[model samples]
Target: MTGAAQIAISGLDPRDRAAIEQLIQRHAWLIDHGKADRIGELFAEDAVLYGIGPDKIGRAAIAEWGRQRAALTERRSRHLQSNILIEPLSPETARGWVALTLYRHDGPGEGLAMPLLIAEYADHYRKAPDGAWLFAERRLSVLFGAA
Candidate 1:
């Protein structure tokens, strides 16, 4: 198995890992589909997101940012997440990284399309009282195609 997989196997519960993975996937889907108003549902009340313009603190601010982005009807985007690796910090907390590839364009299809950005998301998660995982913090690091 890969190093990250090995660490995940040793450090985190299988179910918790799966739940966190789903949380990550849901974030991508919501953003790609213009469901930004619900973006806060994936995060803790006081979550912080960095590396996307100014840092957004708290769920309200994050949701507002999402609303602003969703207002651009002409701009289209798809966020692909892969190479997810999750590690447990405590029963209630975990951390992980996801390889992010972003494809974006405006108006109709072009001759060819390419990813607009390639990056990794460093994520911290917290388990809620209801046993749901939520993003506590997420920081993006660009590997290429920064704009």
Candidate 2:
């Protein structure tokens, strides 16, 4: 594991940090809005998603999985991510973690549950040739109140 000192020693430039933050924001928005196909753009071509089920590799496969997940009945959800920490491992590689809270309703008339599903997202990122920060891998770990 990377120590606190290591994280303190490593830093991402403002531009890199901003790009990554934007990438994360867009990811949540796209997923919440049932635009799962667009979520693929935020990932690397060979990205891996250690999602709710088995690990999904490659952007195409990930997108397909997201599409199927989005099709699983009409629902509404709002995702809020906070405490984002990005540690630069190299000029082109970094690791990030963020706390996530999901407010969800089962259907059009269903209301959100009292206790939210609080989770943390651990991400590996790589700078692409196009100067975009893409997720190399993402794993979501729920802290409490599973949905």
Candidate 3:
């Protein structure tokens, strides 16, 4: 196993770049705000989200997964993203892999169930005719974690 593997964000862009940036931002926004139901708005209805454990298919299942996860923990989490690499797979499609670091903060003395949960997201983007580049699929892989 590789020790300390990290995600890398690089390359060029101006307009297309913005699409990739928005993709990640939306991900952070939905997760951090505890609005897991809103994930359906970000992904295609038929899109799949992997690494969210079993029953991982379609937007509804993924949204349910997020809700279940949120119920299991009491700590408030903040998702820290870095080392993102977004590549234009095509005019209507793009791919990105980014690093995710989640901080679960409890009260002063509460021990964290997930002190550090680091994963990398494999994302596929599709451009809507209305001009929003939304996620087609998001496959998550755990890079480093305590559980």
lDDT of 1 at 38: 82
Error of 2 at 104 (Å): 1.1
Model 2, runs deviating above 4 Å: 1-10, 113-115
Number of clashing pairs, model 2? 0
lDDT of prediction 2: 0.85
lDDT of 3: 0.72
- What pairs collide in candidate 2? none
Cα lDDT tens digits, model 1, 1-147, are 755556556787789888999999999988888787788888899999999999999999998988888787777888989999888877888899999999888776552368999999999999999999999999999899945
Cα lDDT tens digits for candidate 3, 64-92: 77677556445466788888888765566
Residues 1-147 of candidate 2: C-alpha lDDT, one tens digit per residue? 465556547678889999999999998998788887677888899999985587888999888887886885677788989999998887788899999988877767868555478889999999998899999999998898854
| Model 2: per-residue Cα lDDT at residue 31 | 78
Predicted structure with the largest TM-score when compared to the true one = 1
Q: List the residue pairs that clash in candidate 1.
A: none
Which residue pairs of candidate 3 clash? 9-84
Best by lDDT: 1
The alpha-carbon deviation from the true structure for residue 1 of candidate 1, after best TM-score superposition, in angstroms, is 24
Q: Cα RMSD to native, each candidate?
A: 4.2, 3.5, 7.6
